[model samples]
Target: MTDRDRRNLLERRQRAAAEFVAWSDHHAQEQRHHEVLLAQLETHPDQLDGRNAMAQQRAWAQRDQHRRHLHDSALAQLRHAFR
Candidate 1:
């Protein structure tokens, strides 16, 4: 590759890396939020108003699945950066 092409590729990779870091941080926050919600639902059932335990659990599961999808997408982006 030409020097200019190489430079552009490197810049793109750097940008992708930075973006992956930010995405990972956001994923971590989501995980923490999920954990907090799960704990509250499990530990303080009475405080959840009329929400049923099964419904609360299902909601958390759905959020967790979405987080996993985000994580997979972030990892794919990071992998593409190396290519």
Candidate 2:
């Protein structure tokens, strides 16, 4: 590739890397939030009964799934940018 084309590609890769870092930060925050919620549930099981407990569990699962998806997407983006 020409010098200009190489420079543009490098710029795009840098932008994608920055975006991946941001996504990773958000993903970490989500994981931390999930951990805190789980800790709360463990500490105060009585506070969340029947439907509330089930709902909270489901919410945690969904959050975890979303975090995983974000991680996967970010990895894919990085791979694509490098390619």
Candidate 3:
């Protein structure tokens, strides 16, 4: 790729990395809030995707996985750009 194109890719990835960091921080806060809420509703857990804790945990796991996917995709693209 041309120098300008590489520079642009670098800039875009930098912004994406920064945004990812912010999203992670925000997600952590939201996770904590949900944890608290779950604790408060120990008897029910509010039917998140199901009627039990396992279902809710699975759903949350998927959400976390998606965040990881975003990070991984950015890293892979950055690696490809340098090649």
Candidate 4:
């Protein structure tokens, strides 16, 4: 292959590697967030009652939505890396 082609291939490989790292980091952070939430619920079981439960549900739903968005972005990045 020509020098230019080799350089392009190297660049693409670098991009894919970077994307993999980014996705791994995002996944780790998401796991941490879940761990923290679980700890909170465990420590304060009373907060899961009645009105508080509804509020917690809404908050969790919002958080889950944001997390899903981030997860999708990560997936897209990884897909681009392979392409």
The candidate scoring highest on TM-score is 2
After superposing candidate 3 on the true structure, give the runs of residues whose Cα lies further than 4 Å from its correct spot: 43-83
lDDT of 2 by residue, 1-83 (tens): 99999998999899898988899789889978988988867876587377777788898888889888888998888888888
Sort by TM-score, best first.
2, 1, 4, 3
Instruction: For each candidate in the order shown, give its overall lDDT on alpha carbons.
Output: 0.84, 0.86, 0.68, 0.76
Best by lDDT: 2
**Which of the two candidates, 1 or 2, achieves a greater lDDT against the reference?**
2
lDDT of 3: 0.68
Better of 3 and 4 by lDDT: 4
lDDT of 1 by residue, 1-83 (tens): 99998998999899888988898799889989998987878687486465577778788889989988888988888888778
In model 2, the worst 10-residue window by lDDT is 40-49
Predicted structure 1: lDDT: 0.84
lDDT of 3 by residue, 10-83 (tens): 88778767766766686687678668656755666365635557765666677667767766775676566455
Q: Rank the candidates by lDDT, best first.
A: 2, 1, 4, 3
